[model samples]
Target chain A: MKLLAITSCPNGIAHTYMAAESLRKAAEALGVEIKVETQGSIGVENEFTPEEIEQADGIIIAADKAVDKSRFTGKKLIVTGVQDGIHKAPELIKRFESGDVDAYQGDGKSINEVKQERKQKQNPFYRHLMNGVSYMIPFVAVGGLLIALSLAIGGHPTDSGLQIPKDSVWKQIMDVGSAGFTFMVPILAGFIAMSIADRPGLAPGMIGGYIAANGSFYGSEAGAGFLGGILAGFVAGYIAKWIKTWKVPSVIQPIMPILVIPLLASILVASLFIFIVGAPIASLMDWLTAFLNGMQGASSIILALILGAMISFDMGGPVNKVAFLFGASMIGQGNVHIMGAIAAAIAVPPLGMGLATLLNKRKYEKAEQEAGKAALAMGLVGITEGAIPFAAKDPLRVIPSIMAGSMVASTIAMLGNVGNNVPHGGPIVAVLGAISHPLMYFIGIIAGVIVTALVVNLFKKNVA
Target chain B: MKLTELMDKSLVDIDLNGSSKNEVLDEMIEKLDQSGALKSKRKFRKTIEKREKEGSTGIGFKVAIPHGKSKAVTSPKVAFGLSRTGVDWNSVDGEPARLVFMIAVPEESAGNEHLKILQMLSIKLMDEQFRTELLQVQTVDEAYELLDQIG
Candidate 1:
């Protein structure tokens, strides 16, 4: 039997040559013909020609470092570390003679890389939603902060809420902020479509989103909000991507992506929103607003409980996004209390995790203690993902502890009638003066953080 | 330039007293340091120990090549040692290592001539006849003359 072997080591020093020699000596003793390749400090030596590889019955790669196996496609193969080549040369050669080896097709990836690919390949829907939300956040932050600035510097409190004078520069700043808000829905939809169907889907999705957000197209008073923008994005993206699959003549192919796909997708999506989808979505938005506005003490507490649970459940995943989106949309509808409750809940997870490490240093490792310091800074600025390291390590104990704390905070904020005008959360919002009843908000956050720290420490055993 | 240029008679130890891996490493480093190839033996030893921890340089068949590329090396050098009583080097073949080579290269020493010579020496050591001949050497001059042919 004819076999080929390749051996390599990271430093390209001794192991490579040693392994090659061992394999060669073993093959000769077994009366098997073999050609050995060594990748050493001086580079490749005695490499196999294409014909030699073709004539071989099997190939063995014993490498401590990566060696390209692409040329060995369709050959029976065994791969292992260089140490194995030195020690198990006889056993490895006997495998081919034993007739159990399979031909290699050349594609090999590390286990971690394969797992990552599987995760990305399976959840395009969630990936698309996350893409849209990520693009939409910068607009939300800029618009919300600028409006808050205008209200703080140029406005007095009325029975309705804070309002800026129409002729002032603060008003122009607020107007610029408002203009940023106007693009929010369109940008969300446009990017979502782009993620799904590439650049051709952008124009169609944005146009569809604009129509979805305007009630006049469907003869209604209140427009459809983020929910409508999401629907518009999916519809436009799928339509454009579907159109791409249809075969066209060679003459029309050049214009397909740039002109044809976007044009047709835009028309179909806009018409669908105008003629059929818009009214129902607008009415749905109205129904939602009215329901939230009409909630009594018990109902409002239930809402707070649900929002708090969701915000801490996934810690910035889809469940958290749903709760955040609900609160953010209410800001445009003149109800800031929902967001105030949400803001209190959002800061609890990271703050609680940070506090837990401080309360009991023995429960965490050295790296975690350092991460705790960073988490505290993140919590102050309202980033829920700051708690991810803790939650990832001890999900059952950490998640439940944070959830309970967030529920308490949300309930406190809701009961105290705290109001936040911006679409953000945490002590930073309170410090920025965008929050009403700032004292109550601070109390809620502190209470939640303490609760989380105590509960998590109670569940954890001291690290040995 | 050949491996004989990097390794002289002073660097050869026909009789090594070390009975353990750590002792063997110290003895080898002492030889290289005495030859004035290493600026800081401690720093170079750390680099060699770090590489050993990744995976032992014991390539089985009673042979071990412990090497380090470091800023502490004053020049490229090779030290050879033979422990009549083999030292445990965590070899894949589960045999104690008797034949030892310690290669020290400066971090930025990119000379290819001596590097090719070292490569030839590594490959030549794998030959059973060559190893048996090395085992028969009774003095440093005999080992140095044997290694001198491979340039």
Candidate 2:
């Protein structure tokens, strides 16, 4: 029989994964097929698809914290504490064999649910926001790379900024990239709503995003941009979710998600954005652009420093996503220099740490030195997550070293007038000619890498 | 290369009377030495003791795997022993080891054959049913038959 399980604990760490491993081992011993999802400090991993849930004979939820059970309705489910999963996994799986467990009904309140309600109240925004950013990333990477490629191959410096000839193959590629770029805001808003209210929030969220992206809808140019899309997503999501709880007649209930919720939520989001949020956001965008354009030496350095620190601080966390998203939007607005500074900062951490391992072999273990080789390769491809192993092991030494390196790189790139039209950073973009002032960009990267290596080596004591 | 081929009636001690970790190791080594599996018993014993010092080979669940790969050995072999009264081997789980599998291999065969035996043994050892069945066997031949099923 196919079984699905979710394992979680209060700390979302050891107990959570331990339970998952134990359950997997038990299932293997019993020759039963089981898929387990773990919700830990890393967030949900190995999550079950809709098809997997539907085909499962039973569900096991072993968690101390509250898990959303609304999805497991109509399945044979056993809800218990995480310790049961760790020690009694075989017994828990055997419960299905005994045919003692009953199918889960929709509504229930237990001690776990009460604790869940308290914890769920804490970071609902973070969950929803991450849902959007997670979905938005692939669009950025694909569009950014294609645009960078087309510009490198077919672009020419012109009065109207970098332009491709009309009716050329490269123009088609760039157009495809632009098409992908156009969906970034809508998809981000749509998925955020989906995370909040499931399927019902999608239509209103996308419609609101479309309105937010188009300037004439709000009687202004620059139309509110991604910031507005985020606002619209949250507003539409909440409104649709509120509508879902209305206690409509049985006949109308079946059509509520398909018809009534979508129609009403879209209208509410559209009106709210156009009348209240849109114009102010557009003006703010314009004023911000004017302010950035007017910035010269020291002020611009400060901005780059902040952006650099944000990108490397969490290493692809919410703060990093914010800095990355800001740089991406700036490309569409024809301000590539800001993104150029960000790109220079993005690879500094991984490259610097990798160099540290090379320069000071005694300070790192043999396995860490091997990881350093992979880190160097990832750095070349502009993935900042390569520095994670180093940071996770010794955050005190690694974080400050990486931050300092990136900040210096960004400052140098900005001062040198290096501009990157694509959102991604590192040596790869500069190698592809996506970066202006390529010489200075390379120099900035090398300098940052050197500084990081030197700082980390200084902090790390020699091998005993 | 199979564990059963390396172990025989001469190498199997179904009921080990020893209650100490060193006593158990010495008994198992004596059996293997008499079978001509080791060229130098003193060197092989020293190597196994040195291996034990790095960390106890007692990997809990009442089982201990004490192995040595050294120039003192002329062949790769395994010796099995069962102690009714478990011996203290400083196991991670803080439980005495009741079942012990000691392995000796020449330094030349260490890289490949030694690892192959341990891997094959460990995969079977992970099964609680197999461990229980082996512990219940009445004679050396019965234990040999069970070890033959590993591959």
lDDT of 2 by residue, A161-231 (tens): 45689987999998897786677677778878888989999999888877876667877654555556777
* Model 1 misplacement above 4 A: A1-110, A130-134, A219-223, A249-251, A289-410, A414-438, A445-464, B1-151
Candidate 1 lDDT over A1-464, as tens digits, reads 99999999888877787788789889999999999998877678897776687799999999989887767777899999998887799999999999878988667654344434445445677567656756765565455456545755776543334456788999999888677667767887888788888888999988887876666778755345555677788899999988877656534765888899999999999899888976665565456545544553447889998788878976654357567777887787888989899999998988898899998999886767766775676677676756755664566688899999999999899999999987777787787688999989999999999999999999987654
Q: For candidate 2, lDDT tens digit of each residue in B1-151?
A: 5778677878888899788998999999999899888888899999989877866677566888788877777776888998887899997678899889987766642124344454567546756788898888889889888888855
Clashing pairs in 1: none
lDDT of 1 at A226: 56
Q: After superposition, how far is residue A115 of candidate 1 from its true place, in Å?
A: 2.8
Candidate 2 — what's its lDDT?
0.77
What DockQ does predicted model 2 obtain?
0.01
